[model samples]
Target chain A: MSPVNLSNNKIKLSEVDQSMKWAGLLFIISATLWLLAGTALGMISSYKMHNSNFLANLEWLTFGRIRSAHLNAVIYGWCNNAIFAVGLWIMARLARTKVRHLGLLIIAGIFWNIAVTIGIIGILTGHMTSVEWLEIPTYITPLLAISYCLIGVWGIIVFRDRQSEHIYISQWYILGALFWFPWIYSVAQIMILFEPARGTVQSLTNWWFAHNFLGLWLTPMGLAAAYYFIPKVIGRPIHSYYLSFLGFWTLALFYSWAGVHHLIGGPVPAWAVSLGITASVMMVIPVLVAAINHHMTVLGHFREVIESPTLRFVVFGALSYTLVSFIGSTMSLRSVNEISHFTHLTVGHAHHGVYAFFTMIMFGSIYFILPRLIHREWPSKILITCHFWFAALGITIMIVALHVGGWLQGLAMNNPELLFIDVMKGTIPWLKARTVSGFFLAIAHIAFAINVFWIVLSVKNKPAVIGTKALFTSPHAK
Target chain B: MDWYYYILTGFVLAGLIFISAVYAFHWALKNGQLKDLEKGASSIFDDDEPLGEQTDYSLSKSNYNLHTTTANESSKFIQ
Candidate 1:
């Protein structure tokens, strides 16, 4: 704790920051490019829902192919790569080690992007698997799998080389996520795709895999980022370590079991559905534990959280995590599931988790991380404000329209007197509203991309100005 | 046949996860990892120096036992 030691530690972390510069920049830039691409594809798919003939002529632009393309591009391209950038940086930073395998990571990152490119192309070419989340063709999955392992190895190495004896809670979540993903992914791929599990088992494996992908992989990484940034930015410890322990273990226990709820009312055994419903509802424990822990830590710091872009986005994400999780738990109940199961309600719920909860947190973490890695202030607070409002407002509208429309659609479908076409017709206006929200999200992402490029590409290293009104305080200042 | 196996697999996976959680919780408790509540939470901010002088005041009062080993300070000195 001597000043001399502190100085040395600063120098060491500064080196680690410099070491991550190129790989982090590449991962982020690639992630943003894919975000732009995915948003475009999403708009096309959304528009086609209401106007099926908009691009009906082009076989490649057919709704089915384009929709699958959109998912893979966003999930693998944007989400995965962004996690690589942000998550790996976090692992390296908290591990207090320079990234050792920089060259391998870059190579792995390149191949990861290439593999996803081939996967998207495969989907467009009518080779997509009919499975919901695993729609990417079989040939490209191994490449994606292998490259993910390669990138994941660096995190493991950083943990191995960590100088600190007491591992932070974020590392536990990150490490668990790093290891859990490939295990689940490989099992899902082998059982469902390669061996082709018989009948409803395929459905079981599909939902199990898809839901776990969100629960274990994306959720842990998002929570880890939140755990790190909320405490760091607010300059306070978490509310309680006991709650964190309970939260982590309970989440690990409950989330994996909750996946089977997705198969409710299907041919699956009633007992299995019951188990899933129980697990889903039980998820409230961990979700609230985490929510309370985060909110308590930010207690009396509301003004600070609101002022800091990073805390604002992170707190919003944490709030959405709480909201979406509760909604998810409720929707798993047989009564609620019956009505919301086959409608756009599930779609809204999905975005509420992935985009609102996970992606927004990543965006916030990037705002904190990029400035530190590049050692510069944000070029424009106005742009940051625009991005946040646009994204926030856009997603809110989309979810609301989809939820209301979906509920109505579900009701109409259940009634014997309502024609099928009538139910379909009732959803058009909502779908159009969703498309408009997509434009807002598109504008938000564009602003975000521009701001990131300006920060990364700018040559001037002007000292950052810090104030209560600043978009972000200089990383050096803290 | 597939349904039975699928059900069995789900049970096995859940059982394994349950056991793992219990084991992890036990280890955390045994190792005293769950104690020093404030220090554990602030450990992530170790790489950075203290936020400022005002932070040092609050941190000192908050982290009673390991007042000198604040994560921001300990993080710098651990190496």
Candidate 2:
């Protein structure tokens, strides 16, 4: 901690950020493009739910294909790209290592996007695999896997080259995610798609992959960002290191088994279903641990949460993680699953986890990261505020509408005397409300995209040197 | 036959994960990585970005100036 060493550390950290600049921007820019595309498709699908003939004439835009395309575009195209960008940068910074082999990383990123582009087109054109999370066609998946491996390798490389001997909590999460994704992904593909598991085994494998895709992959990456950003922004240590240790290990142990609960009342064996429910219920331990840690850390820093755009979005995401996880555990119960299964309630729950929790954290990470990468402050605070409110309010409306409508639909469906047509008809108003929410989400996304492009393209201010007093005292701060 | 395949695959995958995790936990414990929890928690911050200083905020002129003045005072005190 000598002055010279402190200065050198600053310079080294600056170097780490500099190395990630272009690759991070590439991933984020591509992620935004996918987000806009997914939003458009989501709007169409939501409309078609209420009005079947909204685009019935177009084969490619049929409801099934469009809906599946929307899911893949958001999860694979938007979420994964954002994870690569934010996750890798965080890993490199915590490891205090400069990301090497920039050319390979950028090339792999381009190929990854290309594969996603092909996969989306395939899904739209009716070549989709019809699997829930693995809708991308089999032919395109190998390319996706290969490119992902190339990109993911850099995380391990950065870890291997880390200057720090003590691995931070965030590093553990990122590393776990980077390794877990490909393992689950490849196994699911081989079992469900390539060899085609027999009978109920295929369904089992499919649910296993689908659930783990959220539980193991996206959840870890999202938590990694929360763990790092929450403490980093507020200038405080995590509430309890012991709690984080307990949380991480328990999540790792329980989450993988919890996915089987998706098949609660299906043809699966009673023992397997019971195991899933048990694991799901046990998830409350980690969820509570994380909730207490995050809430306590930010308890006195509420003012900072309001003032800092990054902290606001991340804190919202962290709170949603707790809410969504608890809801998920409840839904896994056979009694609750009986009502929620195959209903729009499940759809609302999915968005609650993906958009409200994971995507919000990614947005916050982008807000914090972009200034450091570009060496310039965001051009407009109004746009950031608009983006946050519209997104928050829009998702809130959509989840409420869907959950209420879905519960009514579920109740009606369970009644043998009720006509199926009437049950379907009852959901129209809720579907329309969802379309309206989609419109709000679209506006939020457009505002975000506009702000990003404006800041990137503008040359109004001189670049502030990072890791120096100038960064804090720039005359053109805003 | 299908049940056998399912059981074998499930057990193998689960066993691999369990073993790997236990090994990792053991390694961490043996390496003293878990010895100093306090230092580990504060390790993400550096002298330049020390503990108890807000480094990011929504862009605004007044807030920016306030933060800059605080940072200047902190730096002078450190010197």
Most lDDT-accurate candidate: 2
lDDT of each: 0.81, 0.85
Candidate 2 structure quality by residue, lDDT tens digits, A1-478? 3112243333365577778999989998999999999999999999999889988999999999999999999999999999989999999988887678888889999999999999999999999987889999999999999999998898899888887767999998998888889888988897888877786878888888899999999999999999998987876778887789889999999998888898988898989899999999999999999999899888877777887888988999999999999999999988888988999999999999999999999999998887677666677778998999999999999989988999888888999999999999898899899999998999999999998888788877444544464353233464
Interface root mean square deviation per prediction? 9.7, 4.7
Proportion of true contacts reproduced by candidate 2: 0.37
Model 1, residue B72: displacement in angstroms? 16
- 10 residues in a row with least lDDT, candidate 1 chain A: A469-478
The digit string of per-residue lDDT tens for model 1 on A1-478 reads 3222233333355567778998898899899999999999999999999999898999999999999999889999999998999889888887776568789999999999999999999999999999989999999899999999999987899888876546678887898888778878877887788877787877887898899999999999999998888877766566776687778878888888789999989999999889999999999999999899888877777655656788878998999999999999999999988999899999999999999999999998888777667766677677888998999999999989999999998888889998999899989999999999999999999999998998888767443343421223432222
Q: What is the TM-score of chain B in candidate 2?
A: 0.67
lDDT of 2 by residue, B1-79 (tens): 4666656666677678779889989999999988878677776777555666776765433433324332433232232
Candidate 1 falls in which docking quality class?
A: incorrect
